[model samples]
Target: MRRLLSTTLGQILAIIGCSSVATFLLFIVLLSYFGSPPAPPWPWQNAYRVAGLVESLRGAPQDVRNTIVAAVRRPDLSVRLTSSPSACSRQTLDTHDFDAALRAELPGITDLAVRACTSHKPGETIQVLVPLDGQTLEILTDRTSGEPGRFTGPFYSALIFLCVGVAAMSAWAISRVIRPLRQLSEQADAFGREMSIAPIEEHGPLEVRRAAHAFNLMQERIMHSVQNRTRMLAAISHDLRTPLTRMRLHIETHRTDIVPDKLIQNIDIMQSMITSALAFLASDTDRETREWLDLGALISTLCDEYAEGGAAIRYDGPEQIRFFCRPEAIRRVLTNLVDNALHFGRTVTVSAKVLDGAIQVDVSDDGPGIPEDRLRDVIEPFVRLDHARNDRPGSMGLGLSIVKEIVQAHNGTLRLINRHPSGLTARVSFS
Candidate 1:
C-alpha cells in the first residue's frame, strides 16, 4: 500500500477517489438543504384536496354531495363517498414530504388517515379518510408511482465523466512534469559516463526548465575547464622538449668528458617522462569516435604482439566478444597494463571473460603485487612504489594512471588486486 501510494498513478487515483466522494457528498448536502424544485402535486396533496372538498359537503344537502362527486371524479383520479373505513385501516403508510405538506395545509383536522393500498380495479391507489358529520368519507386516488429521484442515469454519467476527465488531465500534467526530470537524470548519468553527452532539453515547468538550463551550463563549463587544462599541459610539454633537445646536444658535444653515463641515462629518462606526460595529457583531448569491436580479439592481438617481441605473455578466454568502446583508448589501456605487468613480473597472462552483463579483462603476472593500502594511490599520476623507485628506468609511474583514465572514460573500472598465493592481477571491467 505504501509503495502504491508512491507512484504517480496511485496518487492520481487517490485524488480522484477523494475528490469524487467529496463532490458527491456536497451535492447531497445541497439537495437536502434546497430540496428538488417543486415536483408535481404529491398523493397527499390530492388526498388533502379531496378532504377539503368532502368537508364542504359535510351537513350539506344530498344534491350538493352528488354534484361534487360528479365534478371531481375522473378515470385516473376519483372522489367517492363510502360507508366503510376498513380499506384504509389495513395498511400503514410511510411518512414522507407529502405527509408534512398535508399536515401544514390541514392543521384543524383531527381524524384523518392516508395510506397506500392495491385494489382490483385501480391496481394501486392512495386511500384517504375524513370524518364528515358522523359518516366516514373515503377518497381514493391513483398512487403516485415513484419516478426514481433526479440523481440517476445522465446525472451520474456526467459526474463520472467529469471525474474521469479530471483524473486524465491531472495524469497528463503530472507526466509532463516528471518526464523532463527523468530525462535530466538520465542525461546526468550519461555525462558522468561520457563527457561528450548532449545537453538536456530545457522544457518543463518554470523551475524544472531553470534546472535544466543550469545543468547544461555546468556541463559546458566543466568540459571547457578540462580542455583548457589539457591544452596548457600540452604547451608546457612542447616547450620543455625544445630545451631538452638542445641540452642533449650540448652534453654530447662538450659535457661528455665530465658527465657520467648515469647522468646521460637520467637525461634520457627525463625526456621519456616528458614524452609520456605529454601523451597522457593529449589522450584526454583525443576526439576518438567509439564503435563496436571484438574485445577478445583486441586482447588476443595485444598478447600476440608481446609474444612476437619475445615477452612471456599468454592469452585466455573466448575467441570473440563484441563490445562498444573507443578502440584506441581501450588498446592503450591494455598496452599499459601489459607493459607494466611484464616490467614488474617475469611472465604475463592476459584474459577476458563476460560477467554480469559486463566484460572483465584480467592481466595477471607473477610479480610482487602492490600492498593493499597503496593499491589506490598507485593509480594516481607520478606515484611510484618504493621498490620501483630506483630499479625501474624511464618509469614516470604514469602507466597505471593513464590506464585508469582511459578505463574511466569508457565508463569502466580498473583495479589492481593481489592474486591468491602469488602474483598481481590488473582487472579492467566495462559494460
Candidate 2:
C-alpha cells in the first residue's frame, strides 16, 4: 500500500487535491466578503468615508485640500488613487475612519458582522456603509444621509503583488523536494532489471541522503558475495577433475573378469554425472567466455554428434545464423535437450531461426508430450515429469534445470511447449 501511494501519479493527485481544498477555502472567504451584508462598523464602508473627505476637501478655500492631495500623490506615500470608483473601492484603509463610516452608512450592518472599522475626529466620528457601487449613495442620500467609506486603489494592487509572489515560491519549494524522490524511484526500477544503477547523490534532506547511502552499501555487498561464490565453485571443480582423470586411468588398466556388465554400466553412469556437474561449475565461473557464434552451425554440430551415436536426430533451417554467446554453454544446453528427447521419443529434431531480433532454438521430439498442467512444473530443478520412467538407471532430472540456468544467465528464456504434430518442444531464445 505504501508503494502504491509513492508512485508519481499518486503523489501528483495528492498535491492537486490539497491545493484545490486550499483554493476553495480562499474562494469561499472572498465570496462571503463580497456577497454578505456589512458588519457593524463595516470595514469596507470606512473606505467610502475617506473618499468623501477627499471629495469634500477637493477645492476648499483654505487650500489645505490641494496641499494634502499633492503630498499624498508623491512616491513616498506609496498610495494610488484611481479615477475609477471600482478600482478605488477595494483599497485597504486606516481602521479608525473606516469603522466610523461603516456604522453611519449601514445601521443594519451589525446583522452581517463580516468585518468592522472606525475613524474619529476630536469628539465626533463617522461610521457608514462602504459604497458597493459608485452611485449607490446618490440613490440613498435623500432617504438617510451619511458619509460612506472610501479607499485609494494602491492597497488592493499591493495585495495582488503579494499573492503572486507566494504562489511562485510555493511551486519552487514543491519541485525541490519532489525531484530527488523521482530520481530514487527510477534507480530502483533500473536495479530490478539488473542494469547498472548509478548511485543517488546524497544532496537532499538528511533522510533522503541516508537512504541513498544505504542502497549503495547493499549493492556493494551483493556484488562481493557473488564474486566470492563463483571463485570457490571454480576452484573446487578444477581440483576434482584431476582426481577423476587419475581414477579413470587406473580403472582402464584393471583386468577384472569378475565384475558383471551391470557394474561397468554403473561406473559409466557415475562418470557421466561427474562430467555434467563439472561442466555446470565451469560455466558458472567462466561467464566472460563469449564469442560471435554461428548458431545454425552449433545446432547442426550437436545433431550430427547425436546421430553418429545412433540417436535419430536431424537438423533444419538456414545454413547460418550468428549471435554473441558462450559457445560452451550453448552446446551444453542443446546436448541436454537432445539427450532428453532421445530418451523419451527415440527420434529428435533440432532447428534454429532468427526472428524478431532474437535467435530461437527449438528442440522437439515425437513422444508422449508432458500434460498441459505440468508444462511449467517440469522445468523446475530436478522435477522429472515422471519419477518411474527409468530406461536408463540413475537418471537425475537436473538436465532441464541446467538448461534454464544457462539461458537465464545469458538474458534468455526457456519454455516447454507441446508440438502440434506430435510431442514436446523445448524452445529457447537469446536476444
Candidate 3:
C-alpha cells in the first residue's frame, strides 16, 4: 500500500480525498444557512418561545364558545395570541410550521403547515372553534406553501453527483500534469544506457520546459567537443608520420660507426614512441575490430623473443590464458614494461592473475625500488627521476608514462609498488 500510494494513481486518490473532505464540510455550512429562520430566539428546532405581557384576556367553559383577540399587532408574526377574560378566540395566520416540520418528515411530505393564533385567559375554561370535517385542518397542515424546498434532498443529491464528476475530471488533470515529468524520467534512463537520447520537446509547465531545453543544449555541446578532439588527434598523427619516415630513411643510409649506431637506435626509439602514442590516442576515438587472441601466447612470444636475445625474461603463468584487448596497443604497453624491467633490474618476472571481474598482470624485477615520493612523478610524460636515470642507460623516461596512458585508454589502472623481495612491482589491471 505504501508503494501504491507513491504511484500516479495514489496521487489522484490523494487529491480526491482532500477535495471531497473540503466539499463535504462546505455543504454542511451551506445547509445550515438555508435552514435558518428569519426571526429571532433561534428556531434551531421547529418551535420558538416568546414572552409578552398579558393583553385583554378571555376564557370560556367547554360547552359555550367565547370571543378573545390579541391587543398586540405585528405584521411579521405568523400567529398572534390575544387573551380576553372568560373567553378566547382563534384565527388562521401564516405557514411557518410547514418549513419547520421538514426534518421530521422523511421520504415525502408535500404539505404547507398553517398557523392558528390562540387566545386564552388563565384560570378559565377556554373555548376555541374546532373544524368539524377536519378537512380544512388537514389541508392547512399539508398545504406545501410555496415552491418546494430542496436543500434537504435534491440539492444535496445534485451536489454529491457534481462532486463525483469533478473528482473524475481532477484525476485526469493530474495525469496530464505529470505526463511530461514521466517522459523526462524515461529520457534520463535512456541517456544512462546510450548517452545519446534525443532531447524531449519543451512542453508542459515552465519548470519542465526549461529542463528539457537545458538537457538538449548540454548533449549538443558534449557531442561537439568529442568530435573536435578526435579530429585534432587524427590530424596530428597524420602529420607526424611524414617527418618520421624521412628521419628513418636518412639514418638508415649512414648508420655503421658507434655514433651512427647510436643515432639509429635513438631514431628507432623515437619511431616506436610516435607509433605507440598514436595508437593510444586513437583507441577510444575509433574502437578497434576485436579478434580472439591468446593472451598467454602473446606474452610467451614476447618473452621468447627477449630470451633468444639473452635477456633474463620468463613467462611464469598459465600456458593458454586467453583474453580480448586491442592487440597492437596492449602489446606496446606490455613490451614497454618488460623492456624497462629487464633494462633496470636485469631480470624480469611476468605473471597473470584473474580476480574479481578483472585480469591483473604483474611485472616485477629485482632492481632498486623507486623512492616513495617519486612514484607519481615517474608516470608523468617525459619525467625521469635523476637518480633512476643515472643508474641506467637506454632509458628515455617515457616507457612507464606510455604504459600508464595505454592502460587508461583500456579503462584500466596501473600501479607501481615496491616488491617484497626488493624490486618494483608494476600491476596492470584490465577489466
Top candidate on lDDT is 1
- Cα deviation at 291, candidate 2, in Å, is 1.6
The residue pairs that clash in candidate 1, if any, are none
Instruction: Give the local distance difference test score of model 1.
Output: 0.74
Candidate 3 residue runs with Cα over 4 Å from true position = 1-105, 110-273, 276-286, 289-293, 322-329, 355-358, 390-398, 405-412, 420-422
> Residue 121 of model 2: what lDDT?
25
lDDT of 3: 0.60
Cα lDDT tens digits for candidate 2, 264-355: 56567666655655554455825568889888888888788888988899999877888788888788888888888888897888888888
lDDT of 2 at 288: 60
Write the residue-wise lDDT of candidate 3 on 1-431 in tens digits: 78868988787778797888799779777645545333422222222211111111212332222222232232332222223212223322123333343323321323323234234222111122212122111111112133235365778788888888788888787778778888888877777677656777788889888887887787776765565456545644554565467666766777455546655665665566556455434545226655666777888899999999999988887777667667877888889899778877879999986777578889889988788888888886545676764533334345676688678877889999987767898999988
lDDT, candidate 3, residue 161?
82
lDDT tens string, model 1, 112-137?
77666655367336666777666676
Model 1 error, position 346 (Å): 0.8
> Candidate 3: minimum summed lDDT over ten consecutive residues — where?
49-58
